[model samples]
Target: MNPAKVALVTALAGGLSIGAALLGERWIDPEGGGIPLAGLGQGEPVQWPEIRLPDLAGHEHSSDTWSGHPLILNFWAAWCPPCLEELPRLERFAQRHADAGIRVVAIAVDRPEATRAFLAAHPVDLTILLAELETITLTRRLGNRVEGLPFTVAFDARGRHVFSHLGALEQDQFEQLAARLDAPSATPR
Candidate 1:
């Protein structure tokens, strides 16, 4: 083989190998944000990790506060439009389900002032928890691969994670969640 041809072939092979490696990396980590995927499963019993954050009123809270009861854990941000759009419906859901021992909790991943402002104007009747970057970590722990806004996680009366949604919860989804949590034997959805 000619010397120039041999060098060209080797360069091409190396380039292709590098390209394949880059493609594989993207497939494994789509967002390139370096969050390891938990691959959380539906119906799989999961323990909620202990997280401490302040509320709009500047009261500190731990995740365990919502334990021992059915909970709707929503991870949202003030900048997310979908998150904002779903707040009213979630508030209504919380109000309707509050008597049934279901606690709706919203964990906001934004500055306290922004969250307070948004809540002050919108007025959601649910527990709000403020977090910084840990909000994304919490969402990932709950099986949100994309860490998208409006992520919701549901826990049964026993405090086992039963359902998780990564996008805005539709009305039907909220109703179905209510039914599942209200049932004695809540199955994974």
Candidate 2:
């Protein structure tokens, strides 16, 4: 075989191999970094879907309006045991961090009657929202599916999802996530 021909064949083979590798990386799991949030390390920004709801007192509210501030969204029904306990803690957390640009949005997924009665007795201090049919639409739209109550989705200032927890959360879990929220830009997300 001619030297020039062998060289050309080798270069072409290398280029084709490179192309195949790149294609595989793009279509398959790229670099194996897309694992769940099991680790405390920062994660990809969760772009939550637009959601709307009413307050306990019956007022139209849109999730988009809460952009620019970090949002703590808690999915709960008035009757959920863990939620009852979490409301007070969430309220306190909201009050403690209000000046820090954190906005706690509690979304109650239950009948308006039940929610009203629950709120009258419990009186949550955080901004509580009612999940109407509109809420159902929005909830389904979110990147995270709503399997049940007590689902918490935390969003950054840009409405990106920082983390989500299914089931009741103790104060420390949120505290760690808050620390991540306050991290400097140089830190890896």
Candidate 3:
């Protein structure tokens, strides 16, 4: 085979590979934004699953521990960089909204030991919960289609899920979510 022919074939293969990847991304995230794959549950009455996960101290707590308040449930892992990046912002939001009855809970989809170590070095004001192997299923039920890190879901005081984001919640996004927190809770069906 000629050298020029081989180069052309290799280049074509590389271009095709890149094109496929971009198309797949577009399909998964049609908006080309941080939003997760849509249609799971938004502006709907999603009953929070009944699972008792543990805190850093190993005390089991129900998912409804913060019921009757606006809640932000963030699914994360210590090994995930984006998850770590959003912690400070979430902590600040939690502290700022403490008096408003808004709760920010971070459910760590990692080992208890890993979560404890990470929290010790980088303390946060947000309530941290430990999840085990059921993390993926739990997050999926809560609108995490890609099962990715830093997934956030917001529930109104009535425990209705109002908003969900797949990626790190940036400042602007958080502002939008904060507004949703103030929205009147859905009337019970």
Candidate 4:
């Protein structure tokens, strides 16, 4: 084969590969992370799914444990930088709002050992749940299309999803959500 012909073929192959990858990212995995169809049901009012995840102590707990309270579910992982950065803020918020009947739960989307080690090093007041394999699916159902870490979903006392955010939440944002939950119109009966 001629040298020029070989170069042309190689260039075409490279271009085709790049195009395929871009298409895959755009269509199959919109989150850009490898999980297919991430965030598929985002922005919908999905009732809290029935969850049975374990804590650091290996004891299983049901989602109903926090029922009848304004709940905040934060999906995080030990390897995610934003998740680690926002934990302290979340802990402070949880501590301050404990008396308000608002519950903050941090669901670790990582290995049990990894979550335990991370929590041991950086203790938090938030209830920590471990759900390694089910994290993606659970988060997607709760309106996290990107399947990204530090995803948060807020639920009313009746277990209705009221709000969701995909990135690190600031203290002020947490305060605003808490205020909304405390409003006369928003309060549960």
| Best-fitting candidate, scored by lDDT | 4
Q: Which prediction has more favorable lDDT, 3 or 4?
A: 4
Task: Report the poorest 10 consecutive residues by lDDT, candidate 3.
Answer: 33-42
TM-score of each: 0.73, 0.69, 0.75, 0.75
Between 1 and 2, whose lDDT is larger?
1
- Cα lDDT tens digits, model 4, 87-171, are 9999999999999999998999877887889888888877998886877888767656445667788877877766777667788
Global Cα RMSD, each model? 13.2, 18.1, 9.3, 10.9
Say which prediction, candidate 2 or candidate 4, comes out ahead on TM-score.
4
lDDT by residue (tens digit), candidate 3, 58-123: 888886787778888888888777889998988888887788888888999877888899999999
Provide the lowest-lDDT 10-residue window in model 4: 31-40
Off by over 4 Å in 1: 1-44, 186-189
Model 2, 84-165: lDDT tens per residue?
8777777877887788777788888877888888888877678888776666455434422334446677777766666665
How well does model 2 score by local distance difference test? Answer: 0.65
lDDT of 1 by residue, 1-189 (tens): 569746854664465456445533432334543322234546645876677888887888887887778877888877777788888889889988888888888889777888889888878778888876777777777776555566788878777766776557777678877887888785334
Per-residue error (Å), model 4, residue 112: 1.3
Question: For model 3, what is the error of residue 72's alpha carbon versus the real structure, in angstroms, after optimal superposition?
Answer: 0.8
Q: After superposition, which runs of candidate 3 have C-alpha atoms over 4 Å from their true positions?
A: 1-38, 41-44, 185-189
lDDT of each: 0.72, 0.65, 0.73, 0.75
Q: State the weakest 10-residue window (summed lDDT) of model 1.
A: 27-36
